[model samples]
Target: MITLDNVSKKYQTRDKGWFTAVEPTSLHINQGEIFGLMGYSGAGKSTLLRLINLLERPDTGKVLIDNQDLTAMSEAQLRQARQNIGMVFQQFNLLSNRTVAENVAFPLEIAGWDAAKIAQRVQECLEIVDLTERAQHYPAQLSGGQKQRVGIARALAPNPKVILA
Candidate 1:
């Protein structure tokens, strides 16, 4: 489960003013459920998603995933916790030098999975995203959509409990 308790975020503008990105809000997402946020540009959709994974720290409130408060975790603890929370970025942040398969295997590697296991999981995830044929290709070699698929495969490689895309 994911819970946001009166969460809010604000940023300081260049003019030394404040811009409220997210208003104080509370939300709950049960296990095995799919939830989406929708709005116009600059509507805090991205901010809200980033808050869930602590990519952007909340100015107020707590971010809890599977009953643990992410905001309270130490850096090392948070790094461990983040393994179970995958994120597919809008920009498809794949390593230009790494092949698709290697990119997908990246998370499993960070999680300390052995080579054989990582290989198997990477293949499975690539298949799921229908990027198996592009596995040996580098990010730069793939089209935009293919790059996005590689990002999806990478996110799924860890079999994360919560995925923010």
Candidate 2:
């Protein structure tokens, strides 16, 4: 389960004023459920999603996943915790020079997976996103949709328990 307890975020503007990106909010999303946030642009949708994974830390309240409080975790603990959470960004953040397969293997490599295991998982993830045939293609060579698929493949390579897209 994902729980946001009165989470909020704000940014300081160049003019020395504050811009509230997310107002105080609380929500819960249970496992095995699919949820969507709908609103006009700048409605804090992306901020909320980032809060869930602590890519952007909340200024107030707590973020919990399956009863673990992400907000209170130490940096090292948070780094380990993040491996179980995956994110696919609105902009595909693939490395321009890395091939699709290499992109998918990036996280696994960071987590210290052996080469053979990384290669196997990369192939599996690529197959899941139907990008196996494009494994050798660089991000610049792919169409937008294909690049997005590569991002998805990369996010899935770790078999994350929670995926925020």
Candidate 3:
């Protein structure tokens, strides 16, 4: 489960002074449930999601995952914690220079998996997203939808306990 306790975020705009992106808000998301945030442009929807991943730090409160306080974790601890919390960005952030299989294998490689295991896991994830045929293709070689599929494959390669896609 994920919990946000009175979380908020603000930014200093170039001409508008301080802008509040997210106000003090609390939320709880249970395991195995699909939750979504919907809003018009500039409505803090993205900010709210970013806060859960600690990509945007909440100025007012705690971010907890499975009851552990993410806001209080050290940088190293946060990095380790991130391994189990997968995310697929709205922009589909695939590495341009890497092949689809390489992109999917990247996180597993960082986690210190052996080559054979990495290959096997990459194949498994690709099959899940039905991107197995495009595994050898580069990001530029695939269409936008295909790129998004690659992003999904990469996000699943870690076998995360919580996915933020």
Candidate 4:
């Protein structure tokens, strides 16, 4: 489960000085539930998601995943905790240099899985996304949907419990 308690975020701009991206907001997403935040562009939707993952630290409030306060976690602890969370970006941030299989294996490698284990997990993830046949293809060689599948596979490679996409 995810909990955001009175969370707020702000950013400093060159000319604007300070811009409030998200106002004080509180939300909770229970386990096994589908949650959606809808808004027009620049409405802080992406910033809110970034705040959830600690990719952008909030200026106020707390983020708790299964009762562990993400805002208070040490950097190492945060890294480890993040392994249980997964993310897929609409932009499909695939590494152009790596093949489809390599892209899927990246998260496993980062999580310290052995080469064989990474290979196995990558295969499994690719199978889940139906991308096994495109294992050797590069990001540039794939269609938009295929690239999105690669992102999904990469997120699933670590077997995360919570996915924010």
Better of 1 and 4 by lDDT: 1
Give the lDDT of residue 24 in candidate 2: 97
Candidate 1 ranges with C-alpha deviation above 4 Å: none
* lDDT tens digits, residue span 25-129, model 2: 999999989889998899999999999999999999999998999999999999999999989999988888889999999999999999999999999998899
lDDT over C-alpha atoms for residue 159 of model 2: 89
lDDT of each residue in 1-165, candidate 4, tens digit only:
899999999888999799999999999999899999999999999899989989889999999998999999999999999999999987999999999999988888888899989988888999999999999999999999999999999988898888888
What clash pairs does model 3 have? none
Better of 2 and 4 by TM-score: 2
* Candidate closest to the true structure, highest lDDT: 1
Clashing pairs in 4: none
Q: Report lDDT per candidate.
A: 0.93, 0.93, 0.91, 0.93
Report the Cα lDDT for candidate 2. 0.93
Arranged by lDDT with the best first, the candidates are 1, 2, 4, 3
| Lowest lDDT block of 10, candidate 2 | 92-101
Across 1-165, the per-residue lDDT of candidate 3 in tens digits comes to 999999999999999799999989998999898988888999998888899989988889999998889899998999999898988988998889999999999999999999999999999999998989999999999999988888888888988988887
Which stretches of candidate 3 lie above 4 Å from their native place?
none
For each candidate, give its TM-score against the true structure. 0.98, 0.96, 0.96, 0.95
The number of clashing residue pairs in each candidate reads: 0, 0, 0, 0
